[model samples]
Target: MKGWRARLGFLVPPGNPTVEPEMQALAPQGVSLHFTRMTASGPAGTHEGQEERNRSQIDSIESCSALLAMVSPQVIVMAHTATSYTLGSAAEAALVARIEQLSGTRFITAFGSVLAALEHLNVRRIAYATPYNEVTTLQGKRHLEEQGIEVVSYGQLANVRNIYEENDERAYAIARAVDRPDADAVFLSGVGMPTLDALQVLENDLGKPVISAASAMMWNALRVAGVQHSHSGYGRLLS
Candidate 1:
């Protein structure tokens, strides 16, 4: 309602608890974020049966559409990176398009944001770290490779369910473990995995750029909200 203030609505899995604060921490001035949880029946706090977990996710888009309608945000962000990364770009884009057609609003997902960020940096090589099962993690790597970015290395944490249960420590540990000397950048996938607190430190320690799903989500959302996108001490996407 205010010119300087823009509202961003995020649709996340019910099991996810990391998107909010991580995105919030990266939000630029004059932008506010809100969230809507969709059905996410899974192991609850670990990265287990991803196929079953994402099945619930596929069923939740309509609910996400409904939530988008209620929020009337300038843009809706699909806050889970795994879905987009594992589902492939076409599937992710189709979901965003479906939600946009349903709600007459635009949307972006974590994969979309990461893709955009990578393009902005002109990077064609990357390494990834994920707290997803092996199946999902490989799917993510394949998804990125399909986009023409060479996957130099990857690390999988195989965490199965909830994100709050997997906190900053896990992210930091995985980040340090996943950094590859040959990769142009390191990607910490999944907004629910909590990487904002570890991203900068990882960059400092690794001496390379790092990008997280949570950070990318905030960057893209802010651009959609018409905010001046700039930040210091983060990654190249914002800096």
Candidate 2:
């Protein structure tokens, strides 16, 4: 198949079962999404375990990203949102810079992409939802605040061992639960949580823009790749 627009390289955490399918579902025609997994181990939902898993990804990113560079993808997307929190915004930016320097490709993380999306939508106050432990969720909240977005309300499906196991209904419920009347947008964090299926529903119900890690990743990947296409059914960021 001819990739007339661009080829996207995605780096996802090992054992994640949702990012690939979710990204593919949001990709526009003429755009191709390729993925490689970083090394990660240990039980999920524990702070030490999550840190170890993130460390594995950080340790293995160079080699894994090098492999993706071989395809000459226009943009590289770090599909793990928690990695940004694990490394903090500054460290994560440095890590992305290093990856770009090594791979000779531009890079975007799920967290970074979501921030850009929120800015693009002019959303200052947002209600956030995530399928992470309290520690990771707090990190995400801090990262968002550093970007100048106010998190008016926040909720999490705490202690979820595998975010991919969450169904769309659960995702919708979380978004609805986290939404606040003062929020300009609803941000559903965690790329591994199935969210595309509920994006439109959430937007309609909340009467506000809805953004998810997966949706923002796809939108940012397309924009960074110079593909000026807009997709429907996801949210205003894409459409």
Candidate 3:
């Protein structure tokens, strides 16, 4: 009866050290998290080969999901947001539909979850922050624009040697730095950089909602699992 209420599965990237722990922290009682890490073949931390690493991880998504499906979680979250960049906004539904059809379980992506959270919060324009390279960062902006969400402003974390090594303070800094008064919310994009701990404070300091891929994923996953969950101190989505 560990997950008698609802069990949420997460398909994570192999090198990410942030998603599982953050989701665990945000999970409500009776709801459990399960993880299946996808392939990451190219390189570990360097941005010089980040594209290759991203491609490798997404290439193995279906296989990883198939393996994860054996556990029969109510919802499976693809916890890498940038993978949607490669797949493009147009193909997002098809990918999720295909996976759900194959696995007979619901599927959601980190990027998709952010969009859902933004919509739920009635966010029109947002300030975007990320620990990704210029190419990957711009791709996220484009993907959001495709969905009718405006990126009022955006920033990338400087001197990020490895996204997985980032912590909450850095997460708080970039989110606050990119926010503008005209923006409806601040969206932190990147599953590897710890963001949940920064979410509440950023919302408090900025007087606006701060949405992150990590936080949004957990909120949406719980909703998909039919768990009526809410816990304050994280962000408005979960609270």
Candidate 4:
């Protein structure tokens, strides 16, 4: 329960049920995780609803961050990956910097972390999968492309009401369905998806790196917090 090395604070969407558990499973011995929810509502089944929910939740970051700051965490993570599309890369960087200044903590976003993880593994072309409608999936793909990563193939579990409730088997299936032989890696987007249990298997079966939103977030948070422990059972990104 003691954070001997560093404590990490997470800002998650209100209805999300996966971020806390997944991040906790990924944390190292000396690291601890704390979470705060951002206000949001509506179904995640449709792109319009998802956008509304994301906007509503992101509006609460400033206030929620203020509360998390009182805990004095070494790092704060923005756990909602979809918000990165709301603000482009440059704008998102500025927003993170602003939050850091306000909270006096280093910050990492899910999208940014995924990008870093891909770059770290020298993965240029990726097969992307998400538990979202086609519209939201395309937005995520566009965002990645704008960041200079190629999305050679993609798939989605369209009309998913609650991504957190998705099973590990489905996550693996989606990743496999989208993957191509030419892709350097496979990316499973969304922190809400239960991806940790499937990451290692996917990588082993595909013979390449596999990265997920939750794994990427944890890796980046640990790196930023100076926790050098390399974890196994998730994937090569964390190991």
TM-scores for every candidate against the unseen true structure: 0.91, 0.95, 0.96, 0.95
Tell me the lDDT of candidate 4: 0.87
Q: What are the per-residue Cα lDDT tens digits for candidate 3 across 1-239?
A: 46388878898887778877888898888886789888887656556777777788777878988888888889999998888987897677888999999999899999889988999999989999999989989988999999999999999999988888889999999988898989999999988888888989998899999989988998899888888978899988889
lDDT tens digits, residues 150-219, model 1? 9989987744455557777788888778778888888988776777777777778887788988888788
lDDT against the true structure, each candidate:
0.78, 0.87, 0.88, 0.87
Q: Give the TM-score of candidate 4.
A: 0.95
In model 1, which regions exceed 4 Å deviation? 158-163
Q: Who is ahead in TM-score, 2 or 3?
A: 3
How well does candidate 2 match the true structure in TM-score terms? Answer: 0.95
Task: Please list the residue runs of candidate 2 whose C-alpha ends up more than 4 Å from where it truly belongs after superposition.
Answer: 1-3, 44-48, 158-161
Q: Lowest summed lDDT over 10 consecutive residues: which window, candidate 3? A: 42-51
Prediction RMSDs, each to the true structure: 2.0, 1.7, 1.3, 1.7
Model 2: lDDT equals 0.87
lDDT of 4 by residue, 170-218 (tens): 9999999999999999999888888999999998999999999999999
Model 3: residues with Cα > 4 Å off, grouped in runs: 1-3
Model 1 pairs whose backbones collide: 45-162, 46-159, 46-160, 46-161, 47-159, 47-160, 47-161, 48-160
Candidate 1 vs 4: which has more TM-score: 4
